[model samples]
Target chain A: MTEVLRVHEPGLFTTIQDTGRLHAIASGVPPGGAMDRFAHSAANLIVGNDRSAATLECTLTGPGLLIEAPCLVAVTGADFDLRVNGAPAPAWIAISLRAGDELAFAGRRSGARAYLAVAGGVLGDRWLGSMSTNVMAARGGMHGRPLATGDVIAAGQSAMAAVTGRGLARQLRPRYDEHTLHLVAGPHISRLGADARAALFSSAFVVSPDSNRMGYRLEGPGLETSGEELLSFGLVAGALQLPSSGQPILLMADHQTAGGYPVVATVVSASMAVAAQLAPGDEVRFAETSIETALQMRAVQREALESLTS
Target chain B: MPPQRSTVKVRIHPLGDTALLAELGTRLDTAVNTRSIALASALKKRRDVRQAVAGAASVTVQFDPDQVTHVALAAAIRRLASKRPPMEEPGRLHRIPVVYDGPDLQAVASALGLSQQKVVEIHSRPIYRAFLIGFVPGWAYLGPLPDELVLPRRPDPRRQVPAGSVAIAGHQTGIYPLNSPGGWHLIGRTSVRLFLPDSDPPSLFRAGDRVKFFPIAE
Candidate 1:
């Protein structure tokens, strides 16, 4: 391992993440990782690293870093104003940097999160077989917290020479502005009012400011449920639960292991990356879909990603 | 412990493309919780599944869509759910001591129209089962509180509850493993640590575990 960069300024909520800690979920630990999985992998692939390599997941804003070694880096996910050595740089493509090169994000031009990956996967403390940070649990990735100023990042030295000139195709780059997500009916669909589907589909919902990696609380028409109060039950990312207020909360990467609210629908995995891109005040619409269609969408997404990694 | 239902109607529904939810009735029944844990345990051991987390009455099974489709995984889950789980390995039993001197203990007793000592007696009388481990790492949901002691969560939640604070709400009680915002009524505090980040498992309680709390002078 070699020191790669030092944080000059750690902007809004930057953390090191990989695909996340999947096996630890059974132990009540959340799969805390890149909110946008596709972007995370794309960033890593562009830098000629393993797709599951840990990278910096900068939320809303990004950090300023001073490069200390010859390295290849790429940024993906939310669009941001990236600069290198005080010069403008493009995102989603590999860029070569040497000692003394400065990298920084001025602000988010669009989108809510971004990924910065360097070759030889950024090193972090391994927890549950992954380096993704679990802030609440206070483990993994910069001591289970966001990167702060003065922190030095170490990266495993890759034997392959640093590669550049790789970029994701325009069509393959996910569009976050669509704001439309597909969903499938949940098990507790029966508990909802008859117009629940219509209410969910027809009404325009806005992502509440109280959103985070845990879940997005949507503000819209109150979905009425007819039965007695429900008990706590296991939930996963993408569960669209209707609370007493009728508004729905879409679970995300860091969502609780269980909740008691009635679930009306679950957003498909294909649309999760899109959901992760949304920021507070973004208009989000839901399209009802079937399981078959959901899987097909997911397959298509996976195929697009494979083209990059392979 | 609540008695098991004669029949538990389990339905496997798609939580999304990547996860499946297996529902096992709705109430806070220990039997249903046990089954949920069992199903989760079995599914977690398989290579196909990414992981499985058991809730009070459900198990959310997560998997990779590229490797297996919802239909195939659902079928496997159905087959697994149908089989009565192998003789269960009993979960670890914990005997936690709590000093019943929380700020809300007196208020709770007055609200329930009982003496402070009587309220403490009722709260400590029953053996509670760990239905799930959630709401934060190591913060367990141990419950089916004695009916007399059951009360709604406080209307206003505190911004930060002290770690190790033993609290109660609707139908359950739990000790705060970490300092966090909470709405439950605090009734006591404990010295036992529920979470150890340095430890492999971290969490002290797992689903299907038994929790018995007793009064302590400290």
Candidate 2:
């Protein structure tokens, strides 16, 4: 029996995603993938799917689902009020849905990005290594846009056959407040005045309404640089770039390949997933860490994820 | 913290965990960037170093904490800077083809107070070098465009710049692979693929590769 979910009302920003294209960025392609990759990976594991499979990354509210055939699925990340056939469904826990069952998701309660995983991943064509939608360029993922109503998604057959033991649901937790993001200095760190540089770590920044997967527009303290023009240079995901106005912008997965603005510091990769969940009106702060600490934190996360399957 | 340098006049500071940023006392030329790269390369050789990238006047290094502390890394950088040698054959040279008839061509040329043909000739003349790969993958920032041809990027970027679109913006020129929004003045298009995912090298131009441009009809 094939497991499928018919979408009655697609959410604000729903797209299929996997790990995303890593090497593509060097060629000016943004790393268009899951916003909260940790949750995406965890959800995939719960459903017994490959961590790299194409799962649905739904934002705040999502479409109501009509489950066909019996299947095991899990919801993680944001705490949306989920329901199965008008009955309350559990968050972060894998649940079984019989044929003709309906699963529904409502608006956000905490985090911004959420993950829905089935035993087998949703079927889709491959673009690079993911089904992720890069909305800016209109490429990949559900025709490269938010899922709309009437979208019939096909779930893998026998996806729910392995349902056996039950495990506890993992909570959506963050180590630091979203308001301040810690960063390592960038190549252009010294060009700014000491006062301006200090403001980057000391001051609180607000995520502007203009924020998206491409980049986060931060509204707060301004960084005045010594030079008016900076030589265009390399940028990474965690880069905290200050544009002409001196307002800092944190570049995200879909950020452009090269930029001319002076980057004050780069956010560590270990904390990027948490940073991805920050929505407009969300506050953020900056903290500094050594490169060694960043790599160590990443290693720990990697080890924890690896132990899940082992 | 700003570092006090006795040999040079540039004030520099540590940029978090990876790089150093310095204000240029004078406008930098190819020679200055070359010197920075050499110093960065030396810093990268330390057992603690993971990466070392050079800007016009500053350098960023990624190092292992177990092998060395931040203070130790800073000292090593200071010591290396004082005894740096002249760089030799830092990177390869590359020539890219461009079709010079983008939507913003005329506006860009006029901003430089030059004719359209002059803009094409001047832009295609120089053999620029790749500074670094950042912002996105395969996006090369070829620097030191002739001063007269340099123009500011658009105040409002185009909704989408198609793949292989060659453009120039403020002392730098590059080709955009994979359609993306950009503000650079589009002078032409390129037949030579700058970025290919399946290709072995992926990106045709790497940091330190010298590049020249050839104009082709749209």
Candidate 3:
């Protein structure tokens, strides 16, 4: 019989995500996906699933899941107090789940989001070649939204044998408490006055409570621009846009495809996972780095992930 | 005489390690938009480009840094700009039927010093072109409005403009595919759905498509 997982209680915000929906920006679709991609891929690896396997991205709180068939599962990201059949369970490692086994979370210990990957991966309709859900657009994933109570999701047939006792190394796990994000100068960086630019690099920005998947609104120094009217242009995730209000907003996975706000800088790809783990009231500082150094950091991160696979 | 090709200078800037922004011009003009669209089409065919999104007056190319460096990618785009790619073929034309009975209709007409009927006629007469798709999914920025119909956006934007609201701001006009808070002056509303996620391609119109709005009686 095919294994199926049923949601008893869909916690705060649980959505299915993969790598992302690539090449859909032409239609104004944001590349929505798992915010902490490193953790998402690591969870899949622990369960012996492919790197791009569809997994559950649980935000803040997690769901109560009832397994209908035997399967292997792993929970990674946002160290949550996890339990199975009301007994304490370990995180960041694959464990065998039997029929009628109930998995639940007590509370989150750290981080803002967590990833749950099951062996053989989760099955969902692929839109634009991706299963990632863009909640704002109500497109892709299961019913184009977050999972609800009583929703039954099927598990794909496993190709590789389930490898038990697999877990990520301690050092490989990302430290969610690290709040300093490395950035590279953006296209419109020169438009700002030297004083405004200095304020950006010197001040610590507190993540606002209004932030969501679209962006992280930071409350810090108000950056002043040259008051030039900027033509609307394509925007990439991680671009730090400074609107007329002077507040900087870091674009995230569900950000608009195009924007008119002047972008002062972009968070480096290597620190995107760190940005994703930040929660409300968290303080963050920015450090500017050369594009060459940013690329090198990304290479190091990719090499680290590759080592896990090997 | 054959139409002269645009010679606008294209400026390339690194967005980050993975993307590059190619600015064709600073203003919103047909020549600048045409160049952006053409360059985007050219870049889309390159293996190094993961995605090429054209905007009002710029094109952003997202590429894999591992596959191609930013410097190499920028050089290729500069070469394409200099050579000038062929203009994009026009997309399917759509005639959208709208009811000219929005709350801001009178306000827009008075602001433009034109009668309400005259505003509707001018808005419906021209076959506008889709400049770019952004701000929202399937929301096409259609433009080159008849000079007499142009007006600035409302000083205070509406808290929420209902979906299917046909609105205008500056030299452009568009239909709201989904209900959203907007600053555009609403002149009408349409029943046609501009976006259907389940449908193949999803959007009813693509960039470079022609759109004509016709007024319907309530």
Candidate 4:
């Protein structure tokens, strides 16, 4: 058994997540997987765990750690300055910790969330085949709450010690940017005024501070529909909901099971991974794409992931 | 003016990549929407269909293109449509208790020009049906609320509407099972646990479950 690491400071927002709930959409459950799914998987690759292994999803910052035993760990997604036992630890490099070593991660720079993966995955209770703590639903992961100071986290096993390769760790970095995200028009595209729909694709939007894993409320031209009242309807990931005010809010991983607002567009799933990296105060634009192109991109990403495991 | 009946017709169009486009004629009332749901369920039952979802008046069927071409699926759906029978299984009824006190409760009541108690009474009067579930886990989109309660959503949605917050937007009423940003007009709250992840049936209300609000004094 690996020793427990005591958290001295559990930064702004930290939660345990694996790949989120899958195939539960029809059950009124959104796939609340890791916001940065690709990064979450890459971190697992560093430690020889399956991509769906539960790991720490730290927000803009992370916690101060008190390591009680030596363990293999790696950090991926977002460039957060990490230090081990007060010494500089290389970013994107797998490193071993001796007994009593302390680790700390600073605020995010290039990405909104950073992943810290360890060997054998972080031990946690699984709800719906994932340790992804959907704090909103109060289910899964370290007691359905974000880690706090004095929290104890233990590595799965000493077997995580067998896979040791710094090169592999460095290769799991995620590509992130503050540019535009591509979206295809949703079912209610006609609900939006022509000018509003055009502006939606052409204009840039800033991610509001109200944003979280559930969605990103964009600050830009609000879309006004000719008709307002419609029945509440089924929605999908990346659904751009335009309320009466016309401002669009892009739904994300933990988004609701259904909604009523007019949908301006649905961002392609492949681009949503990049969208998750957006932090508050980041500028973003929207571009329109064909369903064919979006599906092709999703297919390519899925094939790449399949190759990784195969 | 006569009520618009065109809003509930279910017309399907393929968007390629297993996704289809559905256009509902215009007004979204119960009888027409019920037909939409029946159609969605039938189309979704096919093994080749990946997703069959309904919007206001239309149902989009996303299917596996490699397994079943759009033409074939459309033909199959049209065939199914011809032989479609009326809903034999009426939905189940659930009476949920709600505390009429949320951050947006007073605002919604004022906007509707009714006392909070009256608002609750009107909201609880209708036997609502689950239109669909999609925005968040365990959020039941119940609708066709009394015309009196039809009110516009908040100009600005709250950053976080706590779980079980019973809310209304225009003609629909719903309970948020998880904390989420929503524009719906808040009328009350509940603690009946709409979603229990560990439970065999995670959601309290499924699509087609009948619902009515039971107001509890705050």
Candidate 5:
């Protein structure tokens, strides 16, 4: 039988996301997708779905969902208190839900986002070969917007039989903590003064309330530059751009394709997922690392994830 | 315009682990933009390249580090930059019809010391080139506006600029494809839909396309 889910309460901001929309940046489309990619992929794996399958990326709070058909589901990332029909449900593991079973969150304990993956992924119209929703563009995923209460989503055909009791090992789960985010010097670092560069690493920055999917507006020691206006240039997801205001804004999943501000540094790929878990009011510090070290860290993490399914 | 020049210098820099940015020049020059576009087109054919995003004076190439190392990808881009191809022909010309009756029409005319009718005529005269698309989806940056029409962005941005507002700032002119807050000086409004999510290609204008504006009676 086909499976479907009805949203009872679309908590704070919930949207369907996959790996992301690639190759659309040339047209100024930001790569809007699951902020915590590591958790998104792991959740799909636990549910016997492809790692890039469409999954619900819940922000802050999670939505209350009613299962219309029996299927397997898993929730990963933030330590949200999960409950199935008022009974405690474990996260990071595949759980079976019968028809009319309700799934909801009690409260968030750690991290700022979570991923909910079903065995048969959410079947949504693909834009630029991705089911990920770009809310800024009002395109892709469930009607090209965030899930709202009473919305029904159809599930694709399950590629594997529904399985339960499959759980990720405790060591394999990501740890949520307040620590320094590693960074690599970006191209425009030379534009910054020595004192400003030192201040970037010396002081802690608080994520401002203005932060959103596009970027995290940081409030901290102002970074001083040479007062030169930069020509608009291409930007990446983790770019740490410093505008004339002197405050830094770390680009995220929905960052613009290009920006005119000077980028001082970029968060290492290995830590981008960790950066995504940061919430407003969270304190963050930066430590510099070499490009070689960043690539090695990424490879190590990829290998560890590869071992999970093997 | 003078004959096209070759031998433009391009600098390639690593942008995180997944992308490399090729800086064509420091300013908004046609030669530099052309080089950036040419390099982007050449890089798109490579299997290792995922996306090549062209900006005002640079092109960023996104790739899978697992499939191709940063060193290898940078080397490929360097080779393409050294032997830049000629600029591709501009895409089909898009004629956008506009009603010269925006709220800021009189304000813009007074600031430029020109009458509203002259302002409309000069604004619609040239066939502008779409340099890049950013700020919002489907909002094309069309430009190199005639010197007389160039004006600074308004000191205070409007809380909300209606969709289809044709505005200008500095050396650029564009239409707001969606209802967005903007600081550009609005000279007119258009009926054209710059973006349609359900339509194929969605955005009406792509980079390197030609655009023309004509006046329409309200």
Candidate 6:
């Protein structure tokens, strides 16, 4: 075990996360993990770690760390202006660091969250076989909460030597400029009348400030429902639930197990990467796609990622 | 078990690319929920399915795309849906004690056109079944409340309901396992600890369990 680094300044909401808890949702716990799976995996791949390796998910701002070991590290996701020893450093590439080096992320260039991965992956407290922190349950990660100042984290054994100066291919990088998240029509999409359906595509909805990891409540057309709230049903990430108030809630990684709101549509899994970069006021639109097309997009993205990591 | 109704067919829908939701019924009924739980339990035993969570009237299976295709899984679910739901073994009954003083007790009783004491008696009389555990971790949806006690949720939800706050809404009753924002009408408070994160099985209540509440002098 390698003592990785000590936190000097914890940013807005930095937390250790892997792919999330898959086995625990049956007990009403959601699979909470890095909001952007593509970026999380890319950051891990740059550091010679597997896709599910634990990484620091920094939101808005990032942490200031005092490096305790000579190792390779990588940063991905939101463009946080990374600095090492008071000098500017590039992101999406493995950077070699010396013991006692000062690594900090101060200002955000773009995007809402970022992922920082170490050569051997950061080790943290695990619950239900995942290190992803569920703050609501106070389970997993650094005492089951966001990283705070003066916390020292350990690094697991490096599988292999990650070559320094390695950079992610430009083609594989996510384009955050486009705010449209493509979705597939859900079972209850018909419940959202044609007028509301047209409005969903035509109007750009503003992401409400009340949005968080749980879900994003969108400010858009008041979708009228034909019937009363149906019996509560299982929910998944990216499901767009339309409540009686007319606003749609785009369920995210930390959404509840089930809810009674009528789900009009579900955002395609590949589009979740773009959704992760959105902030409170970011304008978002949704377009409907076929399930077959959604699967094809995922396959294409999977191939692109494989070409990079392989 | 009631006779299987051939009139309504199970509706299976895609939840993005990762999950498939099988909706058996639109209304919240014990028979429908039992079918949901049975279907979820069956799907959980499969190697391809990662997690199978049961809701009040549906079962959602999050499966591995590499291991199984949605088309193939949907077909599998179709086969499983046709089969009769497994006979439910008797669930463990939890007898809980409650303090009858809550902020909404008076309002709930008044809205139901019943005395506060009468409302409490109707609520505690029946042995409620846990249809599902949902909304939040360890919060079980216990239900089949007497018609006399049924009421709509509060017009506005509380921002921070204390843990162990026993509340009701519609035909269901639940205890808040954690401090959370809820719209349920608070009828009483319970001291029972419903969630334990450090324990191997973190949740104290499981889906399909039986719950009965009793009043105690504050």
Quick one: best TM-score, which candidate? 6
Candidate 5: which stretches are off by over 4 Å?
B1-6
Please list the residue runs of candidate 1 whose C-alpha ends up more than 4 Å from where it truly belongs after superposition: B1-8
DockQ score for candidate 3: 0.72
Cα-based lDDT at residue A286, candidate 5? 94
Query: On residues A54-163, what C-alpha lDDT tens digit does candidate 3 reach at each position?
Result: 99999888999999999999998888899999999998888999989999977888788889998889877688889898877676778788999999878888777888
Separate DockQ for every predicted complex? 0.66, 0.27, 0.72, 0.36, 0.62, 0.72
- Model 1 score (lDDT): 0.86
Clash counts for all predictions: 2, 34, 0, 18, 0, 0
Estimate how well candidate 4 is docked, as a DockQ score: 0.36
Ignoring the other chain, what TM-score does chain B have in each prediction?
A: 0.93, 0.84, 0.93, 0.87, 0.92, 0.95
State the C-alpha lDDT per candidate. Answer: 0.86, 0.70, 0.86, 0.73, 0.84, 0.87
| Positional deviation of residue B209's Cα in model 5 after best superposition, in angstroms | 0.7
Clashing pairs in 1: A222-A246, A223-A246
What's chain A's TM-score in each predicted model?
0.96, 0.91, 0.96, 0.89, 0.96, 0.97
Give one digit per residue, the lDDT tens place, for model 1 in B130-211: 9988767787888999889889989899999999999999989999888889999999999999987777687888788889
Model 5, span B1-218: residue lDDT tens: 55544576767777777778888787766667777778888888888888887887889888878789888887777777877466567667999999999888899999999999999999999998887776577888888788998887898999999999999988889999989898898888998998766665667888778899999997
DockQ of 2: 0.27
Which pairs, if any, clash in model 5?
A: none
TM-score of structure candidate 6: 0.96
TM-score-better candidate, 3 vs 5: 3
